[model samples]
Target: MAITIKHHIPGRVRFSLAVLKQYRDLEDWIKQSLIAIQGIKQVRVNSHAGSIAIEYDAQILTEETIKQRVAALDFEQGEAKETEHQYTRGDVAMNAIGTLAAVLLPSRWGAMTTATLIAPTLIEGVNELKDKRLSVEVLDAIAVGLSAWRGDYSTAMMTQSLISFGEYMEQRTSRNSDQLLAELMQPAETMVWKLNDNQSVQVHSSSLIEGDLIELKPGDAIPIDGTIIKGAALINQSALTGENVPVRREEDAVIYSGTSVHEGNILVRVDKVGSEATTAKIAQLIYDSLSSKSEIQQVTQDMANRRVKITLGIGAAVFALTQDVNRLASVFLVDYSCALKLSTPVTFKSIMYRAAQNGILLKGGSAIEKLGQIDTCVFDKTGTLTYGDMQVTDVVPLDGTNDARGLLAIAASVEEHSNHPLSQAIVNAAQDNQLPHIAHGEVEYIIAHGLKSTLNQHCLNMGSRHFLEEHENVDFSPFEAEIKALEQQGRHLIFIAHQKRLIGMIGLRDQLREDVVDTLSQLRASGIKQLIMISGDSQYKAQMLGDELALDKVYAQATPESKSRIIEQLKQAGHKVMFVGDGVNDAPALTQADVGIAMQNGTELARQAADVVLLKDQLYAVAEARTLANIAMKLINSNIKLTEYINSGIMLAAALGWLTPATSALLHNGTTIGILARSLAAKHAK
Candidate 1:
């Protein structure tokens, strides 16, 4: 096979192979082979696109070496190497045709036809026995083989047909569910404009590197985290911060990947690129999580294995008691492996699909199971509970130089040039009130302190109170009582000065999300025993918000490390904790909690560590996930009971000769199919 290099960076490369489009079956074989090679960390093959993305250790194997290895691979050899044990629809259809032919043919021909149809099952059973395992395959083989040995050709063919069809359905359901999740988790590849030799060049995002200058125009998604070096734009950070409105980003402003440019254009110097980008890391985490099994899956698998042994033991007992091959054949037909092993994961996958449709991405079955059991829900204050965007709430003209609207207009006119959150809030407030702009001299931005300019031949300053009162020698003692009152209300005050005198102040605060109260109430109603909040804010502000939300506990002034400690403490106290957060600082806590849910606008690190990531900017998604998980668990348990009880009843009836081999096979397979249907339908339940 010839491979074409699609793109390459330091540690990652993508290749296109036209042969893969024709031979779709080669996808898994190629992926498996590439992943087994040294230094290859991950391989994603898209046969439809004829493309493969490989993330490797660049130090160990260069991109050139990987391409050479790919080119050396033989598709013919790979096709022969791929061996699948599961039955396909064509296999089941052929078996059904064979059963029909056995019944229509003469007795001698029917016996031969039955023997041929049952050969594969018998061989699989022998292989399992050689491997020292009494699997369901072995049970199936014994039942069909005994029926054939007893000269019951029709019964044997029918039994083989039922088993093959059941296996086909089970495999098909599992495969489809997995494919749905894969489609949902796959991230779209992006192309960006890189500045080359002072000219704009379009290239794959994978080819980008740190310090490369990338240009983003209106409606373009920022592909790499970087600092804006030129131009300006209204960037929508809703995907990262859950703020519905777009904010302006100017020169020297830091911009993160995953956010999009709502308007304007800017040149960003890439700080993180390729696999190091937050979105890329998150994509890797999601792929890794797909294969993880939950505790319920493990338990059901163990139960299925144990039941296979029990079925074999019962078959032996029935044969020894009456030396009746017919009874033994019927007894072996009722093994409880198919339903038990397949239904739990099907249910989990179904629920995961439901969660995804509702804007929640459940990483794996383990996340669903753990989320269902969480008793304590802990929330981070800033981005999780609040909108994470400051808005102007009060505008007090302290010196009577301007009314509220006039003070806001003066502040907005100067702050409009800045990209700070507070300045944006003031500008937005002024825009909302249709305030007229007040022209001023060239505004001097003093880094972290404030802004300075000449307004009407007088000095104007806007920044923190310390920047005015201490740095500029402005008098704020006269407004001490009024400032204290606003401070007590948990508002951030921005001091505005004219001619070196305190003129007015703007009080801004990050407002709580509109759905937060309803979300918290739903959490409490859904069996969350303790609703707690952790914040980096002062104790007073934290407690006030906690009280308003009726939370059980509040931990204020929490550091990143302290946040993890709190989760550890709650877990040690016998509570299953679930932490909801969206900042890079919340990564440790997200990892420490029993279940970590990242909001839609969460930082990449937070999303990488979280078990569940909400794709919508809604706090109620937490409660919705919990509800879905609870329903999934209930469905799984019921299916397990249905499988065990129904299979046991069928086996008893077969042992007592109340049912023939054909009838026993029909009932057992029907029960398995019914249980599987119930499991797959979990998304629709409640």
Candidate 2:
């Protein structure tokens, strides 16, 4: 279906409406001149630009004929919304009356479409500013004025409102343009792209600055790639990168050019211009990232059938009511969007600011809300639940000659140059007690194991069993039984020997988080009943930690993709899941979960992977955010219900004619004002 778009509103119509609305007495003059003008849909006499575009049916009217008539007509512009006529030759009110008295003249019907406005010009002389609150009042007064004349106020008001609203939009558009121009300007490049069928599409325009509108529809490349201005377009931004879900282009959401709008229409506003918006550049970042579908998170692929019914029902309801064009247009004013669009986004923005102020940065409000609903908390064992630092949990000496501290000091001296966590832990332990630690010469880290070096001239070795036994002169016989027993008990052992002679063993294990036990109990008590632990560690280690923390499940030796798959499995079972990790490997699972939590102390890559970043290094922050989001959502729903209850009563009374237009306007508009005030009050509410 083709959509009708009016290019712009006329300048004269804007100026005239401005003056006439300011001076009330000039209303008669407008009525007299417009009444006799037959077949005219709009009577606009702009005072500033003095230019107007007359719109009428081509079946009964021609553009040229109407233009000639409009040129011949004479009308005055005055204010009507506020301020009395004070400089009308000592009889300002009388002059205003005379001005409006002329509008009482007989007229023919003419359809006039308004023109685009220059905001700074229009507002220069506007008497009073009317936001959403006062706009309802002005509309109500106009409605009452028409109904009292025993007239069809709906049609008349709709026509005037359409023109007036168009003018108002033009003002906003101009202001937006001005603001954009002030920031940056990129002249539009007229590039003709060759299509598959030898058909070339040309982009021809003026300034192609950032934040300019780009129109797109189904099966179209969201023109110039931008944040969404309108429509819930499901976009395939994949050509620009690897993402599992299609990004939905709606208000506050973004989309890019070369991305196909699969099913819905879109109006995208450019955010980045020129080289920065190159499709290739966007595609590279998207593809280059080792991002994959977090196999762990589930999908809603089966919900299409249920959605089909609701979609049809909603479309039918909207169509049936649109038959009456005036009432259909009225929906734009009393849109369900007032709360959903205005209040909700504003609330999200405010909530984000609050989070930021508390040393947390939530990517967006959607993340916060999603995070609050997480029922299952999945954590990566290393760097997350575990400190990733391996400590000397046990030290078994062979022949009772090598002491734990002496063996560790020797091992740490050999492994001092190593970057491994276990090696650092040994060094830290020695340093903590102020042990006189000194490297006994050069060292080499054996790949897949520990270090090899000459400590005090005996060619010492500190590594796995196989690595230590490789030394030609060392005898593994003495410590063989002891090492085997420790390895059997699932202890990570680093064998230390001097030229094949058994010296001592340093056994290290990853330590758990200090608050892991407390936090796990709290999560279970907080309705997150299903807790899971995933780790790159051995099954024995994972089970040990899981049993200690009382986790419901534990998966060991799982890669990032495997972790994501586990999340998907749980999600498929209809459980809302949350994944927490602090590594480059955890990005997929982080993106996969219903919510992803990034610890502030995590890697930069991991920070970008997770949805919610925990500040203050506490799990309780996650709990607090969930509670806060619950509060925000509860307040939002309550506000919506209240608005509906109040507005329904007012409009229902108006429809019944139990309240005349004036009283109805007062009641309806008064309610709108009250609701606006109430919405603002939420900013201060708990």
Question: How do the predictions measure up, each by TM-score?
Answer: 0.71, 0.47
Poorly placed runs, candidate 1 (over 4 Å): 1-86, 109-117, 187-212, 215-287, 395-480, 490-506
lDDT score, residue 592, model 1? 93
Off by over 4 Å in 2: 1-335, 386-391, 395-406, 410-423, 435-505, 508-518, 559-561, 572-574, 658-686
lDDT per residue for candidate 1 within 1-686, as digits (tens), equals 77889999999999999888776677556654565454666677777788989888887679987897778677776642333355777888888887887879988999877878789989988988999987788888887888788787877888788788767766565555544554454333466778999866678886888889988764456777899998888876654464645799899999877666655668899997543444432333333455568999999999999999899899889889989877888898887998898888778877887788788889889999999899999999877898766889999999876899988999998887554456768988999999998888866665445688888999999997667877899998899999889879888678999999899999989788999999988888888999999986667878888898888999986877899999999999999999999865676799899999988766544665688988898899999999898888888888888887889899999998898888988898778878888877775665
Superposition error at 265 for model 1 (Å): 19
User: Of the candidates shown, which would achieve the greatest lDDT relative to the real structure?
Assistant: 1
Question: Top TM-score: which candidate number?
Answer: 1
Which tens-of-lDDT digit does each residue in 198-292 have in candidate 2? Answer: 33233542235675565554334343646776667666655446564566657868665445554454555678654335334222322122111
How much RMSD separates candidate 2 from the native structure? Answer: 19.9
